[model samples]
Target: MNMMSMSKLSLLSVLLIAHCSTAASDLPKDVFILAGQSNMAGRGGVSSGKWSGDVPPECKPDPSILRLNAKLSWEVAHEPLHSDIDVGKTCGVGPGMAFANEVRLRANESKIGVVGLVPCAVGGTKISDWEKGTRLYSELLRRAHVSVSGGGVIRAILWYQGESDTVKKEDAQAYQGKMKKFIMDLRSDLNNPSLLFVQVAIASGEGRFVDSVRKAQLGINLPFVKCVDAKGLRLKDDHLHLTTMSEVHLGIKLAHAFLTTLK
Candidate 1:
């Protein structure tokens, strides 16, 4: 009502607007990619330990891990998963949460938020299945490129495949070459030669291909790629899949590798 009061109100409003704008600019747009087979799809049921906590009420558990960016208030993608299941009623949690948590811990105060995880991994696919120009591989690359160019940095790629290729020893040996090619293509397309890749080693299971497949996975050594061992971690009842606890452990390991690479 008074001139003095009106002047004070205007100054307060200006300051409020400036603060909000600065906060928004400080939020990050980083992207973490998850790729691979059934394990990454999360076959284990959700655990009380991991799922229980201060998860925002709006959050839902599906194949993908979608969470709110605390700083920006935007929906940033975390984990990786395309479909829930063919039956259409069940979903499982993966290690993406643990990975994201670790990133936040390591990069405190950094203006970076995780974004959409473009999961193009088929359950029973081999390294050869991801060849360039193929329907599946092409789609994967397209999605990845879009995510990278759309104001999101490709922070890292989480890979957990190779079980299918181990049955054939010859295929195992060729896996390194195929994987190398795939990584090269990804780097070229994203225009980031230093893109980081974190891979999961196959855990022991009923399949005879476990050791062989893991060996092949390790053979593809790009400067940015590192392998995380999944052996000895608790697995699901199926003996082939990782339990929620194991998934979390795997995720932490992968996150540690990412931190190391950054250093």
Candidate 2:
């Protein structure tokens, strides 16, 4: 190639590298994965097929807090945080925004920069649906990798699920084992053996085996894991999902667990 052609090619390469560097630098420095089912996807202030459109102060959107949108890009996070990711579900308030806001407030003294939440929860999904090879699992891992692909660091995964598992006696009985495997496989895939996990023990379920599932949740003895009980949190009229206030409380609890225990 002539010097003119080579020089043009070198300029193009330099521009490409500069563009990539800028994009990577724009990514959040602290990333957290939010995964689970309906409750995790959020049902607060949601009844029938609609959300009340009310966002509590604790769960308000913050410019410093970002969410990995369904398009796999970062945007300032707001309430109904899972709306885009959960798709068909009428997402109201989830622990994600509140949790992120709380973390940001408390971590102001630390060097914890921008906070990014990767929402991967699907409403009404069972633990079985999130097995290593399942769609939920794959999407979750994919989103996770994408979240941190641009030089961001995955701080932890905030989990709240298992209500679906309470539907059957056998499922409840096997909850602990499945849950443990899920956590292990996730950490293995993420290649972070010490990745933090803050799980919310179920407060209500669609079936009779609520206690059994909660027992399994609290019974988990894995390292770098913390379980926050939602036993006394208020539920909605349906007696299945938490109320708006309860979601806020749960978010605070999750934040406390992460800040005080896991951090």
Candidate 3:
């Protein structure tokens, strides 16, 4: 090769290395996906088409914690984590921020890496909506991919859903199979057979089939899947969604599960 061409190749390699280093510094090393329905999107302090704008100390944002925005860009995460993603609902305090904060604190204590949360939950979505070919599922995978494109390692998926599926007995009865398939498909598509899952068992539901759905959620005996029961958490005035404090509590529980079980 000519001397000029060799010089150009060396310069290109140098610039590429610099760019990659910058990107690595910008992204977090540890990542988590938060996916589910309204409770996962968060209904805490949300009423009459508005959010109360209340944020608990445990759910506070930190410099070490980042969220993948709707634009697939990283930003400092805060409460109402799904405002842009869960557009249809009045987003409020959810377990996400609390989960991230708790995880960050615990990770920091252990000298672990930073935390990145991918919020992809849509309010009131059914399990059927997250089937492999569906829009919700596609979006979830898209966001997850974008999250890890910057070199972030996806540690686990934090799921809290199934309220929508409780409206009918058929949906409730089919919940187990659908949920297992959902987990399997996500793992397969993500190319991580051992991807950890921390799922919150439903505290409340739309209809009379809450127990059936909860039973199905707790019955999934996968290798890296762990279920955290939310049955005792406090619900809001609507008698359906969890209260703000309850979301914080759930976040703590999720962090505990992630630390003790999934680690």
Candidate 4:
């Protein structure tokens, strides 16, 4: 090739490298994954002008909290954090923002770097739906690996599911085993065997096996895993989801569990 053509090609390669570097630098180094069912997707009432009811100020968005958007890009995180997940017609408050806010507060002298929350939860989903190699698993795992590859960190995965399993005795009976396998597989795939896995016990449901799911949740005892109770948390009018306030509380609980693991 002539010198003119070679020079132009070199310049183009330089520009491309710079652009890629800039994008990777923009990614957050601290990220949390939010995964589970409706409660995790959240049906808490909204008060925003764009939504149905009211969302308290505390539950509102914070600049410090960031999320992986539909385009797989980092953006300011807000309620209904998992909109792209198709969990609801409109997003409402979830524990993500709350948990993130609390994490920032407790980061101590070390400044909390940019926080990225990866919302992969699908409402009404059962534990079986997230089995390794399943569609949901692949999607979630893909998102996470992409985030990490882009220089973002995978600090923890906050899971709040199990309601759907409450509908069947067999589902409930096998909940513990399924849940244990999911966590192990998830950590293994992430290549972080000691990754902190924080989970919220089934808090809202209407089925004969509700308590069974709860019992299974409580029975989970894995290293680097912590399960927070949610059985007594108040629910919304539907009685199948957590109330806005309860979600906030649950977020705090999750944040505490996650932080404790870091110690």
- lDDT tens digits by residue: candidate 2, 121-201: 998889999999999999999999999887889988999998898889999999999999999999999999999999999
How does model 3 fare in lDDT?
Answer: 0.90
* Pairs in clash, predicted candidate 4: 46-53, 46-54, 47-53, 47-54, 47-55
- Candidate 1's residue-wise lDDT over 1-263, tens digit each? 99999999999999999998764454336777667766665554635322233222122343223433222233444332334321222335566666766666666544435434545455666778777777657766666665555455778888877777767767876877888888888788778899888888888533466677777676766798888988888986666768766777776787788777655
The per-model lDDT (C-alpha) reads 0.64, 0.89, 0.90, 0.83
* lDDT (Cα, 0-100) at 188 in candidate 3: 100
lDDT of 4 at 56: 63
Give the range where candidate 4 is weakest over 10 consecutive residues by summed lDDT.
Answer: 46-55
| Model 4 ranges with Cα > 4 A deviation | 1-23, 46-50, 87-89, 109-111
Each candidate: RMSD to true structure? 7.1, 2.8, 3.5, 3.2
- The TM-score, computed over Cα atoms with residue i paired to residue i, of candidate 3 is 0.91
| lDDT-sorted candidate list, best first | 3, 2, 4, 1
- Expressed as tens digits, the lDDT of each residue in 1-263 for candidate 3 is 99999999999999999998886797978889999999988889888988889899999889889888999888889888999999987899999988877877877454547788899999888999999999999999999989888777889999999999999999999999999999999999999999999998998999999999999999999899999999999998888899999999999899888888533
Find the number of clashing residue pairs for candidate 2.
0
Indicate the residue-level lDDT of 175 in model 2.
93
TM-score of every prediction relative to native: 0.72, 0.91, 0.91, 0.87
